[model samples]
Target chain A: MPIVQFTPFSSLVQPAFWHALTDLKIDVLRLSDEAIPVHGSYSAGRSVKDRESGAEIALGCNLSVGGESFSKEDKAPAHSVSATGVFKNYNTIEEFKAADKTALFAQVSDEIWKSITVDRSTAQLSRFLLITFADLKKYKYYYWFAFPAFAAKPAWEIQGDWKGASDEFSDTFLSAIESAQLASPRAFFLVRPKAGSDEPELAPVEEYDTFFANVNPVERTIAFLDPSAAPGNPGWPLRNLLTYLAALHPATSHRVLCWRDAERPAGAPFKSRFGVVSQGAGTGEAASTEKPAAVGWEKNVQGKLGPRVADLAPMMDPTRLADQAV
Target chain B: MHAIQQQYWAVRDYLSPVLKESKFKEHGRITPEEFVAAGDFLAYKFPVWSWEKGDASKARDYLPADKQYLVTRGVPCLRRATALAYTDADEDAERLLSFGDLSATGNEADEWVETHAGRAASTLDSAANAGNIDEIPDVDESSADDVADQVGRMHIQGGVGSLGEIPDMDEIPDMEEEGLEAGDDEATAAPKAAAPSSGVIEASEVEVAKGNLLQVRTYDVMITYDKYYQTPRIWLIGYDENRTPLMPAQIFQDVSADHAFKTVTIEAFPHSTSLQAASVHPCKHASVMKKVIERMNQGVLEEQRKAFGAGAVSPSTGKDKQKKWLFRRTSGPGKDAPALPAGEDDVEGMRVDFYLVVFLKFIASIVPTIEVDSTTAF
Candidate 1:
């Protein structure tokens, strides 16, 4: 319900793929700024047809997330949504609550964290349903991600023409979703600085890591996902939420995109990751293993974004983010 | 095997290993005894479909098999007579289709049950004008009776009431009109449930064989929808002990006796015996059933050809490896899947979907049975 300015991919090159997707009439998804309704009711063990068909409709309230003291008839503030605060364990609140209600969340009482708790402040408590925002009939897929809960908006002095970035990223992601035409899809992945600090404290200069798709989880040794960050893992976690859900039911499958080290294109002047665009070497010879620092090129950033060359190499580039080409 | 019970179990055992299941097939790898054990294990994991073999001597009449067995997707259901007794003879007269829903009271599945049960009224006539109704000839004797009798064996060419046809009716497309003008409209309105009403035959009420057996309420409905198929299709193995096909009863089992009196508005086209009898579901799974029937019809063709008793090969015998494989195994089940004709393989191969435990779970959910494997659902 709060208004905020946003930049799409913070002005990256991948927005091109989204531009092609506009022909499909798919909604561009820029959740960082777009308004999303997050109130749903509570209906348990309903009919399969009823549940599947009306899953998007707000459910009626059965009880409050606070203690069991709420009266049986108390169905106030029925709409519910999930928010990241103190209670989310293993990146999902379900693990924390399912473990044991009193044994867990009751210990939390920080003044600053409480001020930002969407569940308690808006719905009066965190409901297990996690207020789903879906249009299966229209979109055909769902993506889940975590957005930081801000106590106060950052000063506008540093903010760019946010609407441009918002529309660009929205169109790009929407294009990807429509292109895939995935059925009953549920996807969740983290976005973090590959060499810098954790996602919450990421700096614009830090490159976002595509670790899930790039690094194999089977490795005995792990790389620090964000070397300069204080809290994220140095290597793929021995465990994670996506892994848990997949293990819960191996019947379903997940599609992931990852990053890897690879050679530069045959004619490219710079040596870079297979797809990631980097400055050209002055000698035009085979590039080095390490990524060369930015040279403020006038051209669009383009190349593969994964372990190997991909079909979308042309559009994966984050254009105009490095420096003003002119 | 003198007693009916003894005769029935013997046939069940014979076909248990070799029964033509949509998902599971008992192949040569397993012995007949192992087939029975595997089948029994399946029954424990899920409700055993309603099954009982037909008359011993007549099994030979329907197919060349040494035995014949009748299986329902679940327990066979008899419709209440009140739903079918239509009181008038007008275009608006009710053409009630389907039996009542048998799901447990207050269960989540009940909502779906009610929706399916509401389809009792149909746009199809009391008799559909099936221009090409292929009648099945009742098997009169044993496999030893004579090879000529095999020519008359009947299998459904399509789903339900229109399962198979009576070869004598040459003008079947006009059969619906003829049935409409008949003096007694009850039989025409709901052939399956058309028996003269005696105020008897309610669901879960009849006690057959004096309650010694599990006749503990064999409840069933006529048709249900599937997400994969996207069509209203009923799943069942229909037939009776005398080798008599049960298409009519299954179709009209839910028609209230009074349906003959109420006027109706034709909303959908005609389906032979299923609630969705109006149209074939457009999905591949539904087409899979038709593909199966088409292959079975090839057996009919072979049977008709064999009727000449010349014992000579057809000049048109196919050279394809699948056809050759089928020719070798025609005597048993599984030969029905002939490789596609040369050009038809261009599409994705529609292999059988039921080899894994997943398909069994799917069928149970589709049939909407009383008990399902709880652990497998998640």
Candidate 2:
């Protein structure tokens, strides 16, 4: 009998509820500190009553988007606005919106632009799981965002701590996990950020386009169930091997044992799973002659994990995974 | 019914004194009818010649319904046997006397006095006593007074093996010897010693509640534990549950003042529909006591018949046998009754831990709280 030990499910499972991202890879890259010139002042605008007309006026507006100033146009219109003096004052949308404007139309235009451009970088990952520093030190496990199972829209593009290096929005994912309505708990994958020898590449402030297209295929290992992410849609595609395993009789005799601590080889891996291999010089019973039933629900060698490896095989299948999701 | 009743009463009256003194009947619930019924039931349950054919089924079918009801009622009895065996006064005197070894001392003195008295009475035995070798010992009344005085002294000191060793016997002083010679000795006469009182059960209202097929009511009686608690007390309590109270007017009896009176309350729920009645004892002690009483009743039955007759039979004994057999043989009770049909090859028995299931189901309800006494300044 394999000794099957388990960490208290309460501790392990409860943390999993909040820390789904523990297994996913997410990077919250911050914009670099280089100077970028923008032509217009950024602004927030709300409609107010015109003092003379008594009609609603979208007032106090400037530029909406912020970026570096391009070369000046040679031919200027009769009445052109010069934001040069106000560059420092209107670097952000809020600063620009506070500026007095000649026409209500300026504020209205700023409001429309502000509503249109969503900050995709800071957009919340569908689900995130947090991990304690202890867990990081104990298990050198990595998390990566991928749609390995599904190839249409992706569920998550990044994982790990999404908080910028400064830990600006640490509570963002935590609150989402608590309040968001989720289908399956396994909807998100979390991974650690890979450190490189090269110093980080810092880019000057500029308008950022969707960077998902720039993502490498190597990163798409774990499948995400959510469809909104591009390429992966509907649900994850099932792996043939997992499907084949699921097709076998529930009490299949074939044993595929998984080992912990891959470092030192202990007992016969397949032998333990197969129930045929014996330990030592003819001392213990051989697995083959015994004709044991499937090891799906059997104990591990040192014995303590739950729901035998074989039992989990069926669950590994994408089809079954979706079906069994809570 | 009257013959059965008469047989029952005859057995009840004969065994009542004994049954009333039993540990099971301490609360005095065992009525004469019920006690007789118990005996009647046992006789039928395990009949003498039925051993060869004895099986659980036959045993279950043997008991008469009425007897089963009565016996089941007296479920919880007194704590100990000696409580019922000896009355309060007797037990106290016995305790005080035991401390002093009066049985040994007093008996020796009694024998001595009896011999002397006999000899004195036989003085008129004449010729044989007057014979030469058999010359009469000197009959000085004062010398007799010395022996009497010594006996009296011994009784006062609580010494063993002497008449004076008795606790109260010394109070009699001495009227032996000189007093017998003078014939005017009224002063030292022994005071009238009182007899140990018997238990007198009082009549009380017996409430019976019928629910669907069953009738149950709670019966309460003051338990006196002066003498010795035992099976008869429990049996009597069981008997009271089934029928009307035998004596309802005055329930308390001074078996002994050493025994404090505590009222015992037990509920008896009997099913008129169930030819097989079942009773619930408050504790396992009472249940075991009931079983023991039933077994003892079965053992002494033949002797009991000579001494007390059919009424000495235990009511539950017959019913238990019948219920067991009935359940075993025909899958229990009515033919149409819902039951797991037994197959011809099913010898091992249709298995279900029914009792365990019932126990598990209700275990949550009466889950006992560990009562930690917080009163002590800990």
Candidate 3:
């Protein structure tokens, strides 16, 4: 048994999402405001097993974005973070090329190619993080665009002298990501992530009789058809449709309903990084350190308090719309 | 709930007519003429035998209790009148009654009617529904004299037509005379006519021809295993146009290796047409059931895999996966194809392919459930 809280891709008015969350024992983090789009949510138990050994695979990865929106004049900057890499089945670049459907394969045996590496864990870990969004639109952007771009980038291809690197990611990998295709008022899932893992394993469960059991297919199928709402109100209907998916899936705990208020703190790092912070001194103690930081004036600062650069990484589409026209 | 109930009633009503017109129409008719044609263009192609032979006691045993009661109590004279009408086709009744086939159970016939009615609402079946009955083959006066006579009496008895004096019996051909006429293809001369006093030329006969035309016969048969308590006993009554009784019929044959059930055919009366001849049921094995279950599981698994951020396994199932793979691979040579530039170092594409195959195979192993076949041939 695991806990999952479903967040809509847009709004959280859907009773289905709340019902699903309550059943899963995951506190519903209502994405009530207009900011975050609520898509769908669910949590369940899952085991990532090694292909050869049939044993659980231990893996870790972080998801991040590189671009942000600006008002009048702001320069877009490139960003990157470096981390240590472990080659589990370390093989020469040649061995990788001949292997069909392998997680990693060699393209060439040159010095520049030696620096490049591709692994299933790298892409998969990133995907596990993106499905946590409650909004379908956001989830769509992550799956349809961002994940493909990451997969398309050549696994850190290196040029002469190991300086210039070509981005080689495959769009095919994004096809593997799943969507919470349920839209109902009373549905929930048990999300149990593997031990020592941040991601919750998701398993969808619907209430039928007093017994907690797997839902009959009729109800489950309806949820998948429209995961936001149960075809009542057309406005933000996706929220209601996705509510049915809160049960029995992986990454169920990641579901968050948008909770936006005029005075509420921003949820993501990107929101605060780009938005101006207020110094209202509501708690007096923090004010004692600064010369009483400006309070209401901070709201006027443009682009700093809203969605920031890192949040967009999972949703970035480098191909400008105007470029497509050409 | 009301709509469902209404649908059920409609099914019941439609079935009643199909069973009557198709299975029991020729029951009490005197003519050896084909009752209902399978196709209008093929009119003489398929003959429909009647189910009744006109004897009250015999017809009583073949009809269901309720129907017998209706004929006896609701319209008392119908049984005897129909019996007289069936005199010309008594042999047909005897032939139809002998080939007993249990597969032709009235209940199954009713169910077929119900299923057909239920499917009639679908857009695909609307054409078939509209084409029914406004389109039945016509029966002329010359082809249906006995049926015409029987129905005429019935209408008059029910007070449905103007009452008139019964015509003379000598004028109309009796069973013996009709049998002589049936054997003689070429007539030497016109037979002498009798005065219209033997119930042969009643105005009721005209009304029966113009309206109240009898098209089919229906028997309400109730087969019970219990034998005691004769009061309100179960009866299987057969009837012709004039409510004549029909004899029981049965046929048995063997065919096919895989299908072990016997092919039992039974002829219906008057028209002397053979009905459906087939097995009642064919058993299935446990292995077949297991395969069906597996297919269902695979389908559900494939659906779940299509969710967002679902990176664990391939979401697609069945032919769609193959179609997609072929389409993507053949789009172009280098377009979107994963490739390494010349002079590149060790690129590990092999490992990626390995994991992808393992994941695909894992998902493909489970089978999805398919709908079961419930119909039995008869």
Candidate 4:
């Protein structure tokens, strides 16, 4: 899979960015049909299933802001933007039946537009890395897409290009070159109040009990709640919604580290551009070099160290796209 | 421990079965009346009624064969009379009767009244300590005559007035009759002679009106009324008009020895969380002094004596503080005998001698102990 470091447009009006994202050449992870894996510590294990189930069922994502972003902050820097996490189904079942995938692509695009337009949405794109194949048996698979903020319409149109704005670098390495909204997520859920006297108030959790309707605060993942598990038994619904919310307004983010490609931690067996040195003295050992041939500061330098860049190239092996990526 | 246990059992046998037949097992939500009544019962039953080192004395308990078991460690407290006895009169009698060999017992028998010297300083609940209980019987114990008749007899004996001039009034009312008249609206008043007008016509017998000197000084105002004789008993520690407390020596000297047996001095235990006084029993000398002056100003000492005549309404297991005996602001033979008057005071700061309330409660506790009154008491 070749990751193009794809940067989605700031405006959903950009036909170009969406065109490239919808392009079929490069393989991508289908988060819309997948599940995210989590490992954790505690659970109420009074039941046989509960006792057997090891590790708390934590539905998390690489895009989480360490669980803190789930809470709104009044003093967040203006440049610090959040992506709404939106999920979309990949239409795997249709593909199996040999169906045209344009409708599927269109659904994804529509959700992308919604994410850009919707305020405080749950359409984040970086949530894809949270998917875990091990969990496919539970909720099956799904995909996530992230869409950033855009200006209100009528008075202005999104330029589709964000310039002069400083990119937020919680990490300095791999920058978020682009982002996109997964418009119509197949699994996203919004907890709607049950009608009538026992009508639910519109909030994540009512009276502190996790209400499982179209939202699941516990699982931190959102999916259309099981229709059968309506007003009561909101556990599954709320958990899915919460997980999706967590993925979007992640409390922490997964950082891809791209080190300077130069520095290594100190104190090791010496490997020089010239020759390998064995059992080298700690630092002040360059003084013992029989070849008194070195530059300034060499008089004070210690071990034999080499500074040379290694050559690298992309391999031209031919592998199937599905096997390599999704 | 045995004395305390006995006190516990005495109350447990009564107030317990607090709500249901649960007793102490489940002292669930008690009505305020129960709270006041139970508070008093617990206080009296578990007084810090301890004695100093061998200054203590014991009474003969010839019941159980094992002498050790027969004799309890603590000194007798809250005796039926002024002088201490082996144990409470009823408890001692019950124990003695429980023996296989029925033994002889009397007020003078099982009792071991401290030698005059032993009780010399310890009789702190003397009249010198607090309220004027009955100093005079007003009438002889065996006399069945009402106050009017008693006065009539004295007049006839003196030959001062003629019988014809004495207007005939049937069913001569007792001394407490007017109080009852004042309480029950339907009860008609007996006719008084044309001479003895309605408005306090110089109550010929001024001594009856004196009603024995009353002084309720301390917060723990101990009021003990002789149930059998139906006379008020109080141990005062307040001042006379002279502002000087009854001198210690004057108490013993002024009272006759015979007067001692008829009076039982119900003492006060300091207020604890369980048992509290209406006015916190002031601890410091200055505070106690202030409380005394405050009590005098309220004329509670005067109020209590009047209430004594009004007769006790008895603390029912009711939440209304007004129903509790300790709830009087000013006392008289008011409705149902001072019932409404008792309601006038705020429960807080209103002086409540929990011990006194509990005592009356026990008098009416009459729940016939299982061992004692298995059937019924006549």
Candidate 5:
């Protein structure tokens, strides 16, 4: 069995997001360093295949935020799953650099654990944290993104080679899943055989017990909108989902379906994958009782865990605009 | 047979509403009906371009509910206009200055010159003409001094402030120690301590030197029918390398220097809700389209002469035929005749349906770096 390694989420902060942040800082958050809630979104990953080698190249999962991120009333774009995040805007660069990131990570991990075990909310699985210092005068920003995922005591392992959904399921079954996903996009769901029929149907994760009723635990299949394009691995969101699942049915094996539909060429069928995964004994109980250690601060372009800078002077500074207009 | 067919089309076109009732042939302006026909033709030829129903509140009642405007998003601009080679700068500068003079004087006789010269200047001038004496002094002095001073201040503060602030460096090690004391997993703590110390110091330095050189910007270019101008208008929205929206001034670097401020102005897009974008002024679009249509007509006439002899379709007694002949003679030389593909020329001359296709070709010069039209060969 291959040790399942999940691809980490990469931050894609749209230019509109920065412009909106600048507006927010000036109009609403002047001199305030409070953490405000922001919204972001992620869709199923598109696989970039090596033309010659035919090997699937993992374009790291992207969590993107845009101009609408500041508006709590706004929803994610069509066919994407929304994520909630805490945005901490420091008053100065010194404050941003000197802040305790490790403690910040721990706090977020604790909140996520509580959401899963206490509140039983499935959406909390994709919560993230962002810290920033916006230099409005220069139109430059210094920021870091952290997508925390619990490190399972004994990590989940794949029991067999993953097969494409097209090869594993009939056309009718795949179409049913597609319709369900289109009707309501969710991060996680359960795929069960419809009662009195061999066809498959998707149900929300909250209905886990009723969804899998009278079915064997080994045959039960859990599905998620996978944001990883890598053939051998799933995305980071699946880590905490597995933790939530283990808490529900401790120390059990279940089939996992990684639903990837976004990146396919026009007219091509969905390219989802399915495999078997099992957790270690009593791992679910520990996750429910104790806060698990987490790891997912995004690495910069240099492959180092440091803040990225966006020098937007050319695009945001009024003085620069005046000069260009002349 | 060809001459007879050409004569029949010439007669039909004379009676056609586009020519008889509308001013499309004479003034280049089209009626709303003609605009819809052109839009449909453009959408059919280029699937990349599709009609979109924009914000419902902003939708115009004149256009169809579903086909309010045409849009194509994420058009990759691989290089800035400044990056292109401007080999014909002198000719373009002279032509562009003449255009400015003509517009200032309000002379429509040189209207065709504005169309031809505008296209040539957009292609040849690119952004290098920004260095022309007429436009360079204020921009160079203001931007160069301001940018240099700002860059210097940023380096001094960013470099010295981070290094001099001892607590910043001290805090990383302290956090590592705390993680170890708390029995934190090695998976999380190892990456943090390994990078931030040395990486942060080096990253700031590297960012200062090579930031602009590596990044490429993208543009979302849209075309909509202008009711007042009765011509197709183009709008542009730019994004930086990180997919962040570019400021109005920043977008100037991607527009051809000759057209940037003179022909392209910031205006609220009609289809969008309060979204201000840079749009190519449609004041000259009708003239350019008129010139293009005349050129297409000349191509068909040239083919008619080659196949059926010059005397075969001589101007008849009708006043319309004589007027058309006189207009063609005075329009200009056949040197710039459109290179229509062999055997594909329509006997009735270029259809108004192909209006947007030719319009895009004229616009490609103004936004030389944007690769929106390359996929659809005219």
Candidate 6:
């Protein structure tokens, strides 16, 4: 019965992605500052428990971008959810700094909001923004990342204590969800128990209406690939998802499953969580009438609201290599 | 082995008659045929690793069109080699000292060596400095204030589903409205909550403390067949924590100190001309492979002896050993051995086919931190 805080996304840009960006900048967009579409992927969070305290540490969920990102390919590794994002590459550092970040954030949020309310697509819930100034001459890149999430009015609260998925659900039901996730990975999904059996049936978020047809509102279970490893906190993606769900069936209490799976060391048991969440009264009207404020700009290593810089001269510059070789 | 002795063996391997036997028992130097067989076995066993043809223009005619080299990308090198404790008494130091002789008799035949001389420390320092974002100038305050003022005036105006209209810049309010400062506070606060209360810490905390989840370096390791040396060569391309390509010196920090400047050198990879990677010199690969093959054959022979009685499989004769030492592929006609048991065939198959697996094991010692070899129980 505590306020549920979601873990923010930590941007992990692969070196190959930058290499691809460099290539793209040199060969394709010489002098132009275009907003390129890129793809980034995130999987279940890695649980890192503090040794001394034994309390779970809420580490940032990794939103990894790689060389294949530029192609906007949905080549997310198994068990990971891939989402499309916009990459705004500025020509100069001054331009990058002077750019209206607040406005940019709002624009992305508006698109996401429209997708939820108008397009009826929950896939856009994971859409993100990345702005960068590639100082190609110096091999230094200044960049900032934002995984926008609309704030919930009368913020969502946990209805009860969280329970492990394995403890709350049968093995058959968990495996069914696992199989569905593996079959076609999606960030958000809808799950409902079968008519005469304890096993659950899973469907993509787009089929929310049909999937939950004739079922009571309390029986509807909205699930997402939770990227937070912390005990109580969910991932940032769930915020927008709850907003979308609330818009459809406002002020209703719903069972939410934080679907977390370990894909490493093979056969690592699912460490997911099951809980109930509810929006405050009159949330439906507020959701439809007014767009909530959007917030989720990642902090730099210094924990400040600024862009991080990666000076790759030592790696990218041929002259630097030559100088080191001597 | 002494440098002169290694050089003599390397030269002799090139001049020696082609191995005619498939067992690969005598010397580590394997024929191209055996290399392909081993490569196939590697690909079959570990799907994460596969044979790549590389750039079409750079392909070699000798190897198969699709199997010119082996590659496993994005192998996470979680921590630097320096992060791990290494004492002078460790085996790594002894190995380095022993191989230190090879530095004198430079193998100019097939290997390229780049001497670090004394630049490693200074170069690494500068590379570390390059990563420090604090040195970069902050954004001008005046421009930031202007954006803040504009954000204050802006509000969500677009009606529901009105995505078509590209609203004027003034009309579209900046999105980072509410949670910007709160988000930073939450991120910074999360780590503090996990900090230990007591000064006495558990081993798990010590391990976790070593690596911040935020900083992780990755390497894409490639294995190419060195035709001239008749050995599998390893080339490494490393990336820093931010995914920027690591400089040669920065990469050197990840490599085992014993092998860094001694055996690893930066050169254009055989499969790609544009990218220069740090490759472990193949000058001594044949010698090392020969030693590994001999040890592996001995182990297999011991295992076979354990499974089947000593007399069941005839003990290899001196002539047979000499034959194996000289022409490994040519089977000795008089020394016919009994058939291997059902599961023992796997062990026999492994002798030649698992060359790369064994090669990877040996490479692990050189680059101890790069977790590329995922195979267990090999």
Candidate whose TM-score is highest: 6
lDDT of 4 by residue, A8-111 (tens): 11111111112122221123444344322211111000000000111111011111111112223312111122333322323443332232223432343344
Writing each residue's lDDT as its tens digit, candidate 2 over A1-326 gives: 21111110001111111122222212211222122222322111112211112222211111111111222432211111122211111222232323232222222223222222332111111111111111222222111111111011101111211111113112332223212212122222221112332122111111112221242433212211121101111111112111221222111111211111111111211100001111122222332122111111111112221111111111122332222121
Which ranking of candidates, highest lDDT first? 6, 5, 1, 4, 2, 3
lDDT of 2 by residue, B211-231 (tens): 111111112211111111112
What overall lDDT goes with each candidate model?
0.22, 0.20, 0.18, 0.21, 0.62, 0.62
TM-score between candidate 3 and the true structure:
0.13
Best by lDDT: 6
- Give me the runs in candidate 1 sitting further than 4 Å from their true place: A1-103, A107-187, A190-326, B1-378
**lDDT score, candidate 5, position B81:** 60
TM-score per candidate: 0.20, 0.13, 0.13, 0.14, 0.59, 0.68
**Runs in model 4 lying further than 4 Å from the true structure:** A1-326, B1-144, B149-234, B241-243, B247-378
In candidate 1, chain A reaches a TM of 0.18
Residue B73, candidate 2: C-alpha displacement in angstroms = 15
Please list the residue runs of candidate 2 whose C-alpha ends up more than 4 Å from where it truly belongs after superposition: A1-326, B1-67, B70-249, B254-263, B266-378
Q: What is the DockQ (computed on Cα atoms) for candidate 4?
A: 0.00
Please name the candidate that would achieve the greatest DockQ relative to the true structure: 6
Candidate 3 chain B lowest-lDDT run of ten:
B367-376
Residues A85-163, candidate 5, lDDT per residue (tens digit)? 8889999877887888888878888888889888887988989999998988877777788898888778677786667
lDDT, residue B130, model 3: 13
Reference contacts reproduced by model 2: 0.00
Tell me the lDDT of candidate 6. 0.62
